[model samples]
Target: MSAALDQTGSAGHWSPVESWSRDELESYQLERLREQLGRLARSPGHYGDLFGRMGFEPEEIRELSDITALPFTHKADYVASVAAAPPHGRFVSVPMSEVRRIHFSSGTTAKPTPQFWTQRDLDRWADLYARTAHAQGVEPGDVFQCLFTYTWFVGGLGATLGYQRAGATCIPAGSQDTARQISTIFEYGTTVLCGTPSFIVHLGEEIEKRGLSPATSKVRAIMVGGEPGASVPATRKRIQDLWDARCYDFYGCLEFQPIAGECEAQSGPHIAEDFVCAEIVDPDTKAPVPDGTPGVLVVTHLDKQAGPLVRWWTGDIVVRDRSRCGCGRTHARLVGGVHGRADDMLIVRGVNVFPSAVEDVVRAIPGLGDEYQIVVDRSVRDDATGFLKGIRLRVEGSDPALPARLAEAIKQRLSIRAEIELLPPGSLERTTHKAKRLVRADD
Candidate 1:
């Protein structure tokens, strides 16, 4: 049995709110929302003006559903607000003195969304992340190596603080030195490996190149976040087989850091209901979808102190299931982790292809290297629709017949023909930071 699961049956519970019923959770949320709205009402920021314009009295939210009546917050709005005001802008609810941490989105496309966190907010984040590590079975005396970047407006610092709070020794080795990261794992007996699924794969490839046996390694778990991979069946299975560890998926965004994640049961990632009120809604209409249906995840911060967002659209697609988990938590669990970002979907030949879905196919193939890139060329071949879209999947593989097989798998899974180009090992670039998936040939 897994060390975390065995401990979960006895001493693995995180907080009292985890056992609360929906009624109790909702009631608690309403009270907190009242408090949150009242704070925003008196604050000097975009949120205050937003609430005032809605004439939304804190006490007026008699039920949780009343939140829908308010305007939904989007990333574009934050970018514009911050661009006009600079730095945090009116989006910051707390004064400059109260804010201690500043985080920003990847800024890959548009302007980065700046996130402000007060000292108290950091503590709460630590608490939530502690629960995340504990959920995956990290206990006292265990060591966790954090391979994510540690500087700037990134998510790595939170995991570092979180594991320390959870009573585990944290090794802050941001993806720079692969050799050192591997040596630290065995030297420190690191029990938990926290990083993106792509980097984990890179580490596995590095291990094999060094002629080392991971079965003899001390690492026991892998907590994946920052990009989709942990829940991708093929991706997760590959990581599991490589390190022989329990892999857990974490779900959250720059606006809301580490809100939901998986437990030892590994059913799915459970959202912190006491802190975040989550809803899965249609990506287009923004209307609520029935449980177990995939939709854009809209979230509201119930306990955030710096910039408590309400009805913020997270762009990531997920399904919420309230089924009781064997781990004894009633918090809502994302059915299949995050499938893909609505914005990241690639339309090829009138067919939608998610990068993660493509990853599922790529990772399942044996002897395929850890790196892969998807490029969609609009100028390739066009029919009557004016878009003869072609998807080129560049993967690191030496097998001559691998391209044909991969093309067939991509065709079968995504229902679209892809031109697969297999390269020798290490042909594709690797990343210590966020792995770039789509390389647009149109540029």
Candidate 2:
């Protein structure tokens, strides 16, 4: 059966729920939230203990707003629970027998947080991914080459199943040799390329070195996530120019398999309202903020059966728009993708700076390479305040005049002067997975 037929069986969306009104979606969410809370309350695990300590009951959750009364679940909490419990941790709601798979976080900042998925959880994950894929225009006969790693990371396996479920042929080409991967793109007539934006940019450069034009390749769409590049205007334009295809953002993390995704309209990623109830709260106060306000994102699984997360603090900074999208999705849209991770924010001379903001400035300049790094040199600390003395930007660009232009651009955009250092192309290290942008010189 064709993907279109399957998606349209019940309604115009992949599932009938995607087109639901705000009231319908909220009503469904309330029902599922109660069930999830009830399950967590009944489980002899961490959540039950937490609820008992707070004198909170599942029945007390009369409405979604009441969820605010519960304490937020942080990554540290899961790590601590894993340390206390042996295998799956005390946060899991289901038995080990029902768990069909285990995936871990990238562990870039901390140890990999173990995630368990039962058969039902895996099915829901794939179904939600299928919905996202369909919305992003994945269909039968489209060959999707997944460049995400397949080891323990959730991105690779989830994307493979989701695209396949959307009726696309998937090649699980985990991040390995870029040359071989590029060869496979042509060999298999791959119609879609999936991976981090950095890898795609690197692939495009490699294609140029091989005397081939990426724009002329069979790939018609580039589905990117796991980092913040595709949503940035200059970065998005670069990828689109390199591949001559539409660049769609697939936003999710290990904790949430398929949170939100961009439709064909490409306005922004629409949250999976029926799958997860998303909340944006002040990072400091932890109070829910109004829609369209930038704050830390908190996610709760609505129907997850295994390790269900209730108010999992994502720590990702984003703005939520609850208005209907041009594509008719009533689900909230994450404006401009994730602004930046709350922890990733840098304080430079009393000015708040996000690497993405610098990236926007650097990538906008002509003749600059795709790779760049931000350095926080602790050696140059202020004697009086004991704070950062200066910031430096290391970039790959041959033009001597590039540094001056970049410095001015950074100062104008960020309101802080940045020491710009220009290096020859290929000086900076490249990666196939998530790219690290910030580095402390002291480390």
Candidate 3:
């Protein structure tokens, strides 16, 4: 069968769940989930041991509600397992010969985790990506220009395949040269742009410097991922105003190829529960949080074959809403997108500050654009006298007064004064995708 047909088959049918009734889609997910657990339990090694330790067979989880009994798989478990078994770990359901593609994790916290995909897994991931593209208003004949990095990472590849499978022309721009990327957008008359939020902002700045109007360009929509800023209202508004195009937020990782994506409604992103089951749990207790509460995100891939992930902890914080969404999808929705990562928290003088919090304040400042970084350093004084330790804000902008205003705003909002330094135009390095914002000078 062709890739499209294979994907449709894997999804059990292509009828848009967005149109289906809540109860109907719930039934469908429960039915498919039972089958997934059965297939996973039959696999050997770690999964077998896991099922045995749980004291119940996969068949016991026939209903979706029964999932509560299954033990959540944390990232630490996977890290330790991969360390014990080098390269590809024993979590893989299939042999090495069957795997076709490999994508490495971001490794922002530690060593990069490798995820392998079979042809079938790729097809399923592509289908979900296509659903996301379609929901974002991408048409069959539209031309897509991908600006995301494709090097050993799945973001660009998955997007390219998705546009292809959606019957659209895809240009593999591959996150190189900003000048060339802007030139290509005009030359090809591309309608869709995909990349990290920072790269899109950088491209917009370059476009402005070159006397190019994004509104005049053929771009109509920008699909952004690989970072949390895409969903921030202030950041999203800035990018939309710069490009004059609709900005859609997409969230995913190497472990789970298609986690969630925004629809044209531009509300919260719909979790692709058909392929991956998502759960929000208390960071310390490993217990599920109530709807509309913030907690860490945990995921399990339903159709992943090469390296099947079951209840894998993402370590990212999110707010999950079980209530029915306006988009009509029965799947859960992640409100406000990813809040921040648990590991990214900085505790200074008893107050915990997340980069996202700083981002909210920085991006909301009227004069400052979305280009800024937060630097954290330990105090040199032997005795801790003051409440403030060492938090500095490095802002990149041409305007002189923008940095000071941003500093005042941060102080008012955070109740902690931050030393703000305004850098010369283009002083801070710009990344092609997923800009690194936080730097720990203490280490």
In TM-score terms, which candidate is top?
A: 2
User: Which sequence of candidate numbers ranks them by lDDT, best first?
Assistant: 2, 1, 3
Our tally of clashes for model 2 stands at 0
Best lDDT among the predictions, by candidate number: 2
TM agreement with the true structure for every prediction: 0.93, 0.96, 0.90
lDDT of 1 at 116: 88
Model 2: per-residue Cα lDDT over 251-310, one tens digit each: 998888889998888888889988898989998888888987889999999989888999
Model 3 Cα lDDT, one tens digit per residue, 140-201: 77999998888877789999998787767999999988788888889989999999999998
Higher-lDDT candidate of 2 and 3: 2
Candidate 2, which ten residues in sequence have the lowest lDDT sum?
A: 1-10
**Candidate 1 lDDT score relative to the true structure:** 0.83
Model 3, residue 407: C-alpha shift (Å): 2.6
Worst 10 residues of 3 by lDDT: 6-15
